[model samples]
Target: MPGPSPHLPSGPRTLPGEGRTAVVTGASSGIGAATATRLAAEGFDVVLGARRLDRLTTLADSIGARALPLDVTDEASVAAFTGALDRVDVLVNNAGGAFDARPVAEADLDSWARTYEVNVLGTVRLTAALLPALRASGAGDVLFVGSTAGLVSYEGGASYTAAKHGVHTLAETLRLELVGEPVRVIEIAPGMVRTDEFSLNRLGSAEAADAVYRGVREPLVAEDVADCIAWALTRPHHVNVDLLVVRPRAQAAQHKVHRE
Candidate 1:
């Protein structure tokens, strides 16, 4: 007996939709917001997730993307964020930030735990909860927004760097595990990005945050990272960009930055 053909007469099946759908975490500001906007411009219906409802709503309104309030640390919030979506072609896990900077010797255990809560556990929870939807989509693309800090540590950034290293490893492992599935996992690691509130959010003080990059010339911007993410997503299915690390020319590495 002849087996049924897996191939179709016309061609291999593609996602049967005009506009693709994407769910972007941390979409209220910075790289998340910029990526959501870019996806919309590329004809994707984006779902914006963040802890800030007002900011999410405002950003969604501007980009015509749906808004969902999500605290990735909370399992319930993670469930609701993925539950509301019928189909999500792309998942951008970007809802992480550095906690207060303190040396390991003086580090508060609670602060260290908080960083892990948001960066490591948050990504894991969200990704697991949405795996079914991603598999269902048949054109699933998962993007993890990592940092150069993961690759190389800096002084006073032990917790943040450690958390990011976990994210980087997760992305790598996922790529291996999902090889049989029709899903692509990628990591976008950025150097110092000049965002409005990144340093402020990381350091817990606006003045202190400003001081870190005050004299640096032409650091990478939020849009730059966003653009890289969009580019990776838009590539043909046969081409899988495994890992991309982007940094400004001024930034050679975490340990080396030119300040003039």
Candidate 2:
């Protein structure tokens, strides 16, 4: 069975159209899509950002939110995403992924660069661009979707682990930098989420993807992560959830997994 969803405080949290807005990147699918939907249901005017315009549009339509085409790797695209926004109270930096699995000595530099572009630099660009809006809102809450790979090492995960470590550092630094301000920075490190495209996207092949988690029992789901994010975002203004780590019962560690 899946774990219980995280709990929220017992007060009126930030509400939608309360003159506040939320921007969710990588909103085309998985945790990003689920977070966007969850935020919308909580009455937040959500801005969905992703490379796939059609997917963003569909998500926005379903959630009654706005859509923006965002290629996190592109400076201009990140600029456009932040430029088009106003009074953003929440920012979920969920636009990132690993391209492939390979040893460091044999790794493709191009793939490594691509991963850094989306995972590390992309979060930096978007966060920097929206700092002003976040500062202006006085209730800025930033959430970065990190991974368990960041907290530990694994075979064929050099590039991804490096990028996620950078993300973790960035979040930590931001938390310190924004201490004087109302802005709060947080990181959610998830483990083995069974998103439809995650493994396929990483391996770039159906067979390879299928082999990764073929026998895993009760792997984490997108909604589970989304629920955690929602709970974090809804915390009282004075409370800040610095870091949250969530994994399925079958996943005890990065390499120590119980596969049925």
Candidate 3:
């Protein structure tokens, strides 16, 4: 064999996310917090953002990251958050949540609007505000934390499903629009994740949220989803993970789950 071919390609000289700045929203709890922690350990200069300044500050100090107040649904908040950032190599849009679980026939229009405001409109606003900074980075990444609800609908989840569907499409459209750019657009969609506040916030009670996972032997936790996100972001610059859907072994589909 020829001793090391001169024409062969070499591996990356530096680790992915090394010496880069990553901004994570909705980072007060759940997947957002877990992702911020993981990314910080991976060598990125992480910035945690959420409306809860107290929680954000605690988490940031623990991980040696910076914490900033951000309310994605508020235009003023988005402007202020983006204005305070000096560099943004990675933008993790993780601020959205499900407010209610009701069927279309009994739909709460207010809840629907709130859902759309945070999941769809908020993501658009922040991404638009940071586009210039991302473009300037030369090797930027935009990652959306979406949901499996975006892929399939379930009973009593019209508002959340619809909003996540919008997120799915937004990621698709942006990727298409930025085809020739150096930016990498990625989306991580998780199924049946059992977090501290997600289910309780949507279902409206501790017991109600517990009932959602009563018999399930194993359901995904926030760290599980965060692991998937870290892996996707650490890939080679040219390798864009368009969409990564991760679910627990107990969950096979949106309508199907293995129970005790």
Candidate 4:
């Protein structure tokens, strides 16, 4: 991406999030939490949803937003979460994670199943439920917090990479399906984001997680990705930022990361 040109508008003349409700899934921690906070600051009536109600509620209270229990993998949970919402102007599909790093030869079918369940199926479920409310908003935004892994393949990353690729295409197909609707489908794909629980949860150990970013001086953090999300969303309604791929300076590509 290139730097903003002087000819472009300095900022949105009207606040897009004002007087509107935004729902953020996976809001209990990491990029999800950061995004929820950023959206709240942007003047959206933000709703935080995750399985961990305690952390979700705490974060919501601190940010002046609402918290609700949500397990996107569970049909009942998703149904309940969507039923509770009265209105939705923005749907931030950030409730996904990578579960393993293994080659196809040593594939763990269960892990692959879990990864797809959360990343692809779960996202589709929640988005489908909220499409009506978003359409009714007159100006709606559907933002997918995707990953650079979605765009590029790598060794020992079949499960995660495949799932994220589904997300990438999902965003593409959605944009085509709703061409003239008063809604925007946006996807934020971040690379080398060093969040607290993302690697830890995937690798199943703290030391293993630390090693993932050990040599990097400044890997992208949760807040960095969150900033990109909020920036893309706060743009003028007509200015549809279809996809934004953000990565730290040290990371040039999935296979190329400067580690000094």
Worst 10 residues of 3 by lDDT: 8-17
lDDT of 2 at 123: 90
Candidate 2 error regions (>4 Å) = 1-19
TM-score of 3: 0.94
Instruction: Give all candidate RMSDs, comma-separated.
Output: 7.1, 6.3, 4.0, 5.9
lDDT of 4 at 10: 75
Q: Model 2 scores what on Cα lDDT?
A: 0.89
**For residues 24-43, could you state the per-residue lDDT of candidate 3 as single tens digits?**
99999999999999999888
For model 2, which pairs clash?
A: 16-43
The digit string of per-residue lDDT tens for model 2 on 1-260 reads 96655674655776743566989999999999999999898888899999999999988998899998999889888877778876799999999999888999999999999999999998999999998888888888889999987788788999999999899999999998888898989899999998879889889988988787789988889999999999888887788888899999988889888988
Error of 2 at 138 (Å): 1.0
Q: Which stretches of candidate 1 lie over 4 Å from their true place?
A: 1-18
- Judge candidate 1 at residue 218 and give its lDDT: 92
Q: Model 3 segments beyond 4 Å from truth?
A: 1-15
TM-score of each: 0.92, 0.92, 0.94, 0.94
lDDT of all predictions: 0.89, 0.89, 0.94, 0.94
Residue-level lDDT tens digits of model 1 in 177-220: 99989899989999989888888987888799778888789998
